[model samples]
Target: MTALTLENFLPYRLSIASNAVSDAVASAYRALFGLKIPEWRLVTILAEGGAMSQQALCGRTRMDKVTVSRAAIALSERGLISRASNPGDQRSHLLTLSKAGWELYEEVAPKALELERQVFAGFSDAERQLLREMLDRIETAVERLEAKG
Candidate 1:
């Protein structure tokens, strides 16, 4: 059997890289917009996808219910997002960005894109695309394993 080594493990490497990138981005988001990664994610999703219940946000974001609920509460408290009774399901509330939220998104999206470009500056477009494809495949593989488990 092969000796286990953390440095040689793909999952370890993947996690380290992911944490480093997320930390950098999180720092920037906090500094520039006072938004945590999850909060920004919810804002962006609501901006793009329109009103959605917390359950739907969880599905769309792959964030757990607690994280989504906390972000939704924070955004709502800030007046960045407003909650309304879901017409489809009165038991659940749908969250939608307020005008302030739209305004914030417009300002943040460009900075986010610029940050992305800076992160991948040395990589060509094709390389970036390939990386994305590989990440998608990895997610799919993990999901398959999870389903089996």
Candidate 2:
């Protein structure tokens, strides 16, 4: 067998770690609040931003338009959110958290934080900081490359 290199090993390890964390968080959110990853993302964005258009939400959550639209409709049906016409744009609607949505966010945010903390519990503060910095650098480099093309 050939020797392993950082280029190959790093991506494999990161993918494994990402999948594990994603699975754990998805399971926790589903069990605790019956929310899927996309739904949770929409709720989190609405909670933080108050109100935003679906296009803006897609950008903020890094989710596809269909997923965001479906989640928005589901949340609105559940009485957790409301969609209204965007004053500036006739084609897009703005999404906002309803009272129920805010309540749900309040209920689930702590649990989500706890889940994330437990997931990263093995990492020390310094390690976590370093990991974050490194990840940010990698993201920036990738974005720069994409921008050039």
Best candidate per TM-score, number?
Answer: 1
Q: Which sections of candidate 1 miss by over 4 Å?
A: none
Provide the lowest-lDDT 10-residue window in model 1. Answer: 17-26
Best by lDDT: 1
RMSD of 1: 1.1
lDDT of 2 by residue, 70-103 (tens): 9998888899998889999999888999999999
Clashes of each: 0, 0
Worst 10 residues of 2 by lDDT: 5-14
Name the lDDT of candidate 2: 0.90
